[model samples]
Target chain A: MIVLVDYKAGNLTSVQLALAEVGHESVISSDPSVISAADRLVFPGVGAAGSAMEEVNRLGLAPVLKDFVATGKPFLGICVGCQIILDWSLEDGRTACLGLIPGGTEIFTPGPGSKVPHMGWNHVGFYRPHPLFEGIPDRSHFYYVHSYYPTPSDHADVLAESDYAGVRFAAILGRKNLAAVQFHVEKSGAHGLRLLKNFCAWDGGC
Target chain B: MLTKRVIVCLDVRNGKVTKGVKFAGNVDLGDPVEMGAQYYRDGVDELVFYDIMASAEKRPIDIAMVRAVARKVFIPFSVGGGIRNLEDMREVLLAGAEKVSVNSLAVQNPDIISQGARAFGKQCIVLGMDAKRSDAPGLPSGYEVYVQGGRKAMGIDAVDWARRAVSLGAGEICVNSIDADGTKSGYELKLTRLIADAVEVPVIASGGAGTPAHLVDVFREGRADAGLVASMVHYGTYSLPSIKSALATAGIPVRSVP
Candidate 1:
């Protein structure tokens, strides 16, 4: 079973609905036992990093998620879920993160013409080959809607890059059993669904 | 590179897809869920289900209808109309909507915008403004804000309100023109441009979209991030693919149909 961690910081129904549309059966849970036993896990969240981290710590999910990643099972994170996996985030004024990934998140600098939040469909160009993007085309468009993005302490952690406001941020990042996307794959139409389907079939291999 | 979006607005009343001219003279088209699914299949970028009668009638938005549409549609969809407070917003978001729009309520209590933004993140809160052209004194932009589904004018300048809403944490803004709505003439480019230029957040130009050319104009001239269509797509005047293909041919970037 695939467990979607519900920290109650925001809604998980959209993610569940997307999974159903892609012919997958998943349960939303904060229960550590259910989450630990799952064959695969997906952490999806939308909202500020500080509040999301609060709920994750409140539900005692931070350790459970860390343990799940160590089990070498397939794990996927979306949007804000991808941000909190890092060591820190600039949102809500220098908040601490899960510290699983090397680096932290930074607020996108608003340029002369660029807009913050970056709310729209943008392209994600893959930097290397991986099962998570097997059938997905290079530079495929994905729905992105966040002001803060993950900047790994190590540059090698970035698997896919998308540019905005003169900075090429990681659109997708993978480290062993854990993989995350800065965009909303659940809301990215067919391209996103295909990504989810590929993650479903992956066996946690490089 | 980011692509421009084409959104289809279904002004639903009583669970049926209805279209009205300037928010009146309703005509039932079909089931909202069914039409939304078809549009999704046809490659629509986004969908908006606005309860036309919800705000005016002073009733909570149809949750069952929202659930029904959210079930059939996989892409990101927003629900609006009759969402009075944060409770209503939470209920709709929990029911499976990615975003909830606050229109009339935001005008009455501006604090709700900040509250919703703080509680659910700015990305989930959408500021929907219904505006009409006016020569009323002290209105700098010559456009007035309307509430109650375009029934009452707030007498406040639309441009000023848009800036204030963004300052309060609205992630995106959808501006619908009451004058050009259902006219099929095209969007109110001047009015749209004012708000789009006044705010830093992505602005969606709603109302008065009759053809693919209109969308191109909105993105190029009005600097709109997205275009919202109601009667055009609902009445079979244009198909999603046709419009997107037209946009691609015009050099406006759009997602390739899968």
Candidate 2:
């Protein structure tokens, strides 16, 4: 069963229903044991970086998540979940992150006439081939609502990219057994469901 | 690049959508959840549900309804009306709302905007202003702010209040023109431009939208970030695909429905 990590953040029902739409039955739990034993793990969040990390640590699921990644298990993070996996974030101020990936997050300071919270559907450009994105067309649009994005030290981790306010930040990332997308795949309509299906069938070694 | 958004607003009362003209005469629409899901399927960029009866009942937000709609719709959903404190905001967000819009409660307690932003990031808070043109002079167009579904006027300058709300940590603002609502003439362009220029955040122009060209004018002439419509969409006067195509043809950067 797919395990959805709930940290008292934003909506999880949509994620649950989206999975169900794809004929997948997942359980929402913050329990480390269930997450560790699941076939795949999904971390979905929509909020600040500091508060989300605090909840992860409070539930003592941080170490469990690290072990899950170390085990080469399939894992995915969405929006704020993707940001928390970075080394740190500079939102309200500088704050530490999950350290799963080597990099830090920065707020998207758009140029003149560009909106801050890049909230809308934008096209995603594939950078490298990955099984998680199988059958998903290049330049396919996905729903996004965020002010901050991650900047990894290694360019090899990027799986896809999207442009907003003249800045092209990383939209999807994957290295070994772990993978995550900055956009809300659950909210991206049919293409989103196809992406989820691809992830569920992916072998972690890729 | 920022794309122009087309939104559908639902006046949800007791879990059912009730449509009216100038917020006076009421007519029952269909179920809120079913209508919300229909809009989502039709490729609406976002959905906003305003709880018009929460304050009259003196209860918290209708979280169950919010959850019901959120569970079915994949796009972003925002809930407004009767949100007074952080607890109320938390309940709505937990119930699947991406953002919480404050109307009457926000006017009564402006500090609640800051408090809500501090507790649950700024992007989750939207300040909704109901505006109407006044006959009095000394004010440009005599813009007066209204609250409680535009039934009462607050006598406050709409421009000044919009500036204050942005300063108090409102991430976005929705200017709903009560005079032009249900008229379908077009958006109050002058008022829309005034507020859009007054604040730094994205401003949504609500009310008086009949045709897709009107939406194009609001985005170009009024310089609004988004446009909100109700009757025209509900009554089947326009389809989402055709409207988006018209906006794209007009050189407005709008996401086409796939």
Q: Against the true structure, whose TM-score is highest?
A: 1
Task: Indicate the DockQ of the complex predicted as candidate 2.
Answer: 0.52
Q: On residues A62-156, what C-alpha lDDT tens digit does candidate 1 reach at each position?
A: 89999999999999999999999999999888998998789999888876557888888889999989999988899988989899989998878
Candidate 1: where is the Cα deviation over 4 Å? Answer: none
- Per-chain TM-score of chain A in candidate 1 equals 0.98
How close to the true structure is residue B206 of candidate 2, measured as C-alpha lDDT? 94
* TM accuracy, model 2: 0.94
Give the Å shift of residue A34 in candidate 2. 2.2
TM-scores for all predictions:
0.98, 0.94
* Each model's chain A TM-score: 0.98, 0.97
Estimate, for each residue in A1-206, the C-alpha lDDT of model 2 and write its tens digit: 89999998646877887888788989999988999999899999887888998899999988999999999889999989889898898865888888899998878775556777887778889998888878878888888888998898899988899988778999998889889889888888778888888888877877
lDDT of all the models against the reference? 0.90, 0.86
What CA RMSD would candidate 2 show?
Answer: 2.0
Q: What is the TM-score of chain B alone in each candidate?
A: 0.98, 0.97
Model 2 lDDT tens row, B51-90:
8988878787778888788778877789988786889898
